[model samples]
Target: MISPEDYNRVKDKVITIDVRTKNEFEMLPHFDWAINIEFSEFISNYEHYLRLYNPDNKLIVTVCNAGNRSGQTSQFLKEKGIDALTLQGGIYNYKRKFK
Candidate 1:
């Protein structure tokens, strides 16, 4: 798992997965760097992310509103044999600290 500060240092090299509902993401302010994969469809489409973005050992940073969903997503990815981890606090924290 990467700290928000550490992640920010290499933000360009990381892929941020926002595992929040599409509506939730839209309702709040937007984050250009994040890709939304709603919690409901996360498990089914996770493989696609594993295949497309960072297929061959690329780093992934999973994020959620406050970290719960992203934390779960990290576990799911780890179970699937991917080296994925969660963002410490998620977008709520990101916006507060960075934006």
Candidate 2:
């Protein structure tokens, strides 16, 4: 399992995938470097976004508002043979524990 501490340790080298709504991301405090894929957009325009991401540059970490969606996304990527992990408790926990 991916731990927040470890995530913090390697955050700079990791690619954080924010799976929250665009409005939610805009309203919240989060890592500045995180990439937003907004869940709805991800569902409707997945291929387009995937093509835009350079997954080779960093280790992938999928995160949702709460860990649910990220976990599901991570599982999908893993099954497709992509290297990815989820932020264990999502941004809510990040706000509580790290922010």
Candidate 3:
């Protein structure tokens, strides 16, 4: 997992995937460039989402409220050879550090 500081370093060079539900996403603070794919549909529609935003297969940064879901997503993506990484403390810690 990468720290929020590390995330900031590559934010512009990578694709940020928010694995939160649509409603949660709407209610929470988030990055403007992040794509909301939610965890449930991430695996099934990953390619489509990637095609819609980042077809170049850039490094992917997965994030959630507390890192759990994002961690799982990162593992799955890594297994599929997607070169994905999870945000070390997720958005909660990220906010604490950056807010």
What's model 2's TM-score? 0.84
TM-score of every model versus the real structure: 0.87, 0.84, 0.94
Question: What's the CA error at residue 31 for candidate 3, in Å?
Answer: 1.5
Between candidates 1 and 3, the one scoring higher on TM-score is: 3
* C-alpha root-mean-square deviation, each candidate: 1.5, 1.9, 0.9
Which regions of candidate 3 are displaced past 4 Å? none
Model 1: number of backbone collisions: 0
Give candidate 3's TM-score. Answer: 0.94
Question: In model 2, what lDDT does residue 18 have?
Answer: 88
- Rank candidates by TM-score, best first: 3, 1, 2
Cα miss at 57, model 3 (Å)?
A: 1.3
**Candidate 2, after superposition: displacement of residue 44 in Å?**
5.0
Clashes of each: 0, 0, 0
Q: What is candidate 3's lDDT per residue for 28-73, written digit by digit as tens? A: 9887788898898987888788788778889999999999999999
lDDT of 3: 0.90
lDDT score at residue 9, model 3, on the 0-100 scale: 86
Considering only N, C-alpha and C atoms within 3 Å, which residue pairs clash in candidate 1? none
Of candidate 2, the 10-residue stretch with the lowest lDDT total is 49-58
Better of 1 and 2 by lDDT: 1
* Model 1 TM-score on a 0 to 1 scale: 0.87
